[model samples]
Target: MKQAVVIGGGVVGCHIALELAERRYEVFLLERHSRLGMDTSTRNSGVLHAGIYYPADSLKARLCVEGNRLSREFFDRTGVQYRPSGKFIIARDRSEISEIEALRDKAIANGAEGISLVPQDTVQKRVPCVRCVGALHSASTCIIDTGDYLTTLKTLLMQRDVHLLYECPALAIDGGVRVETPRGSVDADIVINAAGLYADEVARMTGLDDFTVVPLKGDYYCTTALPLEVPVYPPPNHGHGTLGVHLTPTCGPDVIIGPSETPSRGKDNYDIETPFAVFDDSLRDMIPNYEAIRPSLREGFSGNRPRAFRGGTRCEDFIIMKQPDSVIHLLSIESPGLTSAPAIARFVVKMI
Candidate 1:
């Protein structure tokens, strides 16, 4: 049997490992952390994207739509906890109505299902507290219990007899597929790198140093105020490198907000000192009574996105390509990456 080694225990790596195992390959998963999905996988908003963002021809657009469908199927088969909570992209002013319409067109072009533009009255009826001129409703958007989903994937891999090597970091690649690890060396026929924030560093170990991973830090805040029944978001702030502060209803009573984006110098930087005013200003226009609940917003946690840059040029789309010597590298998989994991696995399996 051919042996395949997958580095990183995030959702993407787990899916890739599972897919390879189903294909009858002897799969081994290596994780630097003690448990799976401890990094970017469980961090950030757990929304299963409806593939509304990204260019029409990008891999992100294609895989995200397919992944959204496949993820729901996986959740149902595994009995994982998830909420089919729909999402609304709101335009707070008349000037932004055109942007909302553009997003609707893009979502339709990207094959996203159940997307339509709703008038202000409909938007207010759906989200009572939201003050918007217009909105693009995505009815298929759902939020998954990321931790439970990861556990389900881990259990499935174990049932398939895929070897799980925890706390084993890949140090280097001596030969084609020989990975030197802290525990021991693993010689495999194929190597897959899905090492979240450290993907570019992992690639460098194999003499592929064309890309660099720039860590973008995002901070989340949880509010004691009543949670929305659905998610409410604004148009993405492409210039600031983030989807502006939005409200996401978790599986609980409280809501999550403010994944304010800031470029960081290192990957492990999880500082929580980001000014709340930034988030306050962004949300004031969308949430009518924002000042009344401003005191309720409290610091939650932070995460780092591994943004890949080649020759100082930022790569906006997901990078899934083969390098020399039968190695597949998946770099800079952010945003819809969680939603696109399954589809990405299928795509990678076909490439092999």
Candidate 2:
């Protein structure tokens, strides 16, 4: 059997490893941390995207739409818990209505299922507290219990007899076929770089240094104060950096809010906290009585998105490049990554 070495134990890496193992390859998965899904995988909102945000025909758009279907199937097959709560992109005024209508057109172009424009009265009736002109509802967007999903994936990998190496960082790559970790050296027919924030550095070790991973930090807040039944978002932020502050109904009671986007000090920097005023202003825009629940908006966990840049220009789509000696590098896998993990694994395996 051919041997493969997969770096990073995030959702993407684990999925890739499982695919390789099932294909009859001797798979060895390496992780820098002690557990899986510890970084960008489990952080931020756990919303399963319906591929509505990206440009038509982009890798993100295609994979996310396909992945959403695949993820729902996988969850049902594995008996993993998830909430099909859907999502709402609301326009508070007439100025934003055109933007949401455009998004509906784009969603149609991207083949995202169950996307429709809801009338203002219908939206208000469903979400009484939300003040909006109208809303774009994505029926495929759901909230998955991230921890449960990861645990289930891990169990599947173990069942396949894939070697799980935790706390073993891939320090270097010799000739793109040998992975040198602090634990030991591993020789394989294929090597996959899914190292999340450190993927660029891993690529550099193999002399593929054209891309850089810029960590975009986002902070979140949580509260049980909002009676939101599903995700409530603003029209997509035109800045292309973030989706702006929105409220997500978790699988549990607390509603998550405010993944305020900002530049990080470094890849590992989560110390920079955003001001409360930022979230307050954003919440007040969508909900007029936001100040009443301001006291309940407590700080929550933060996550960093591994945004890839090439030649100082940001790469908007997911990068899955194959190199000599069967090395595959996955970069700029943010946002829809969690939703696209299964499709990404199948896509990477096809490269072999």
lDDT of each: 0.89, 0.91
lDDT of 2 by residue, 119-140 (tens): 9998888788789999999999
Candidate 1 local lDDT, residue 234: 95
Candidate 2 residue 51 C-alpha distance from true site, Å: 0.9
For candidate 1, the TM-score is 0.98
Q: State model 1's lDDT.
A: 0.89
| Per-prediction TM-score to the true structure, in the order listed | 0.98, 0.98
Give the Cα-based TM-score of candidate 2 against the true structure. 0.98
Tens digit per residue, CA lDDT, model 1, 1-352: 9999999999999999999999999999999999999999988888999989789989999999999999999998899898998999999899889888998999999999999998989988878988998899999999888889999999999999999999999888776589899888998999999999999998888778989998888888898694488899999887855678888988766688878888775787888756888887877888888878888878888888888898889888999988865899999898889999999999998888
